[model samples]
Target: MLEEKKFFIHEDWVVVILAALIIALAVGGLILPVPEFNWSNASELFQTVLEPRNLGIIALQFTFVFIIAAIGALLNKRPLKGYLISFPIVYLITIAALILAGNSQVKAINLEAVIFSLGLGLIISNFFKLPEWLKSALSTEMFVKIGLVLLGTGIIFADILKAGSLGLIQALIVVITVWYFAYWLCKKLKIDDELTMMISSAVSICGVSAAIATSGAIKGDSKKLSYVISMVLITAIPMMIFMPLIAKYLGLSQEVTGAWLGGSIDTTGAVVASGSLVGEEALKISTIVKFSQNVLLGLAAFAISVFWTYTKHPNSKDPDSKPTIGVIWDRFPKFVLGFIAASLLFSFILDPATVSSVKSSLKNLQGLWFALAFTSIGLETNFADLFSKQSKKPFYAFLLAQTFNVVVTLAVALLLFN
Candidate 1:
């Protein structure tokens, strides 16, 4: 039994590499190698900005990944079997519902999310226990890092900067308040330090995605990752539904409120959904705010890691036992690379036509790749066991962080914008 289990883990590297190659190939096919196309300024209605046609293109491309993940989970019964199966299954269920309902764009985006989750789920479920050699080659940590690197390729920091001084200030204030408060609350609630940090960071930063990347970077507990994700998903839908309504009641400009909510919310997918409820400008602003928050991820991780080292281990010299300055660099998630790269390419080039095509391509690949990573995360961690713990600390931390973010961001946006 021991030998069999050992071999199982060793086999994971094969899955990791296979998963990466497929994702990379898809990206190359869609956006990496493609040339930009340009179109001059033209006034268009807000509804027209998110072309349903473009979303459809994304969905069609990602369906294969979802199917593989969902089907593979049904066939496996090893560790983390629930999320391993749920990742793909959820995608199929959600995307199929959208497709059947004739919401083509949503169907497409969901398709991308699903496929991305599926690939990751399969890899994490079965391979996490493989040989040290295989584990070394393509662990979840490696994939998340690589994903960050690839993400850099898709962002244009300059373009984000164009949103101006207010955007930067709002993002900075909101992220700082939320992250700090969440940490305090979690500690008060007596949650383990690692889990507390992750939940707080996820809520105050860019939501589930940010939480996942940061968790991977710091080698956080697996159970901690699941809790953060669960909170994000649970809070996301209700927030998405009510936030726009709240904005309307407050007489807040759609753009302002959307930006506030997007930056403050705990998940990117939900942010996009919430923004669409308002208008195109709101949608655009919200995404930028959210992205700006995302831009700070690398810096934030490093800062937090420094804090953890001094606080978590005052005297321990063992590098792995406590935070090491080197760990931040070694563990710095790589998806930031991909995000930064894309941003720079777009900012400098700014060729509308080619840029759009490339952006779309990268978005699709990012979505799919993320889905795979999600699957891996879900499969490796046991959700049932976690729920049983009733981690009051994490919950308290998330609530406090989100509350602080809302208060601080709103105050700033009002003072600055008004």
Candidate 2:
């Protein structure tokens, strides 16, 4: 006698209900009347996205992201790391496409961001080890650049220029100088190059994500990546809290303060949080400036890849022995191309209505997806690899860039935006 059994491990109803909940909340947050419990005005959600009160709501949402990221600690020991790695990658890719395409089909859930983040998170939780080839720029760091590219729809470059071109110049100076300082300090300390780079970039750039990306770029050991992320996330909480105090103490104008915070902070969520606390004008100005620098990441990554190819390869000893164009192509991640393409296409092709729609949708989804993505990052990386002695060099590199980033960025912020 044989008993027939259904082969389902999870309930379809539960998946449907979660999906519905996410979607309904996202859309309702934007379309329906928000309960008076919070000050969110659904009617004005799209029109006044940059308003100070709305910015507060956005900040409130990011709290969830931080919590999930902290929970990543739960998955540290087991098979979760592998799942952590891949889930963020895929989830990020989807959000990129959705935002770049300018579709605000959903509201609060940010279907695209959630899909990419949760999917990636699930994968990373289940599987952390990757093939040697996948570990290179292809899987992690390059995709971060890709995420930045997709984020361009939210950035209106013309608005940035109108605000102040030198603002961008200041930001670049800050990011580069801090990075250089971090690098030099690490080298003098004889810290591992890969880990140094991870920490430095994460600190200098957009926080945990950048740290993870650089770790992959330099073939940093896993433990190095974990510790660097830990340092960045932990320090970020305080930086976000204290930056407004520094801004006001320095007597910076709202716009100037915006530029300063945007330029200085490592995480986008943190920047937005700090900026909103200052004033409405600061939030708007800071977000735009921060995005401008974000756009530069692709070029930086490319430059780094090229530099590494020429300087460190076994064939570097021979003047004529260089990576063939093919080898260069092979080593470089192709995902960045998709990111660049999305930026250029949107920059030239999209009209106002389309861009508006795209931004609205992404705005709604951005924080939540980012939160989930970082959680996945936390899940995959570990305390062991992050603190390892082998991480000295990468740590040095990351440290170098981040130090330069803070000083130079502040100078630019004060001079131009002031």
Candidate 3:
């Protein structure tokens, strides 16, 4: 008798369902209010961020997310008891990170909450040994996939086209050129395929998201994913701070500068920060360009999944034989489907009024999910593992690829935007 596949919903499908439900709830009028985290000082921190109303809002947000996460855990057949006990602790840590990120000084430096989340978790994990239950409860991939799905809602195709056709054109040229260059460089450096893929995607596409998508598609090690994320975040800081100054020194036009920043910078937050330093037009153009790239994430993930399935799957019985369509389908990440579906719904199906109304709420939830995922990643990662001697080659490759990305994006930007 063939085993009953119908009874078992794959974790990827569960992620898709959970992501859909979250979007449906938001669009169906359950608009969760985003809590205020902006604070200038200790006084304002207490008076504003920690005020009764804000605290209540935070509590409500936590409850909503916790419930959704719990449902995901249940559907995925995770140990509910451990997840229940551990998730709140993670949320508390993430809240502290959010508060830290809200500080005026932190905001001034363009430090994001996810950085703090990762840092705090690293501090805890490195300092003390964790219980097995807590370790098992870390649903890093689940959180990330759900966040990616939610991310799709913000990638409204019309918005990208309306903003600038040049932005989309630049995104395509930059991503394709940079990805291949990065991939070839990593291969030449003899970095393992997993790190190669993650590093390549990070350099060529939107940094963290690309890395995450690649990792998910390939079933990569979380430690490697964390390493790639750390590199992206760390490299992003200097890029964000100094790239605008470089643009000004070169006397580049705001449009070219924006295109360069958006195309080259790994992270969206960094792109925005760098663009803001140049001018309002730079910021606008940079954001449009970034969104154009963001719109390609689902397609890239699908392509990567198919490629990985065909070429690198370890379980293939015959190394020379191409996998059947059913085998490929089985190996494909279902969350990418959710991502594409969400993007399509937002792009064409939803009315502007409905989309506008629910967008902020969904975006907040998306950010929170990513923050949670990073916290889990940090907790699960060992500092030693990330910085082992083996990582040096990939690090060098990433820096070199980023440099290539910067040069190529600048060339593309000047050619198109100029």
- Per-candidate Cα lDDT values, in order, are 0.58, 0.54, 0.91
Give lDDT tens digits, candidate 3, residues 115-190: 9999999999999999988989999999999999999998889888887699888888988999999999999999
- Arranged by TM-score with the best first, the candidates are 3, 1, 2
* lDDT, candidate 2, 334-406, per-residue tens: 4344445555545666666655544555444434344334444544554455556665555455545554665
lDDT of 1: 0.58
Say which prediction, candidate 2 or candidate 3, comes out ahead on lDDT: 3
Task: Compute the lDDT of residue 387 as modeled in candidate 2.
Answer: 54
- What is candidate 1's CA lDDT for residue 187? 70
Q: In candidate 3, how many Å is residue 229 off?
A: 0.5
Q: Is candidate 1 or candidate 3 better by lDDT?
A: 3
How far residue 76's Cα lies from its native spot in candidate 3, in Å, is 0.9
Model 1, total clashes: 48
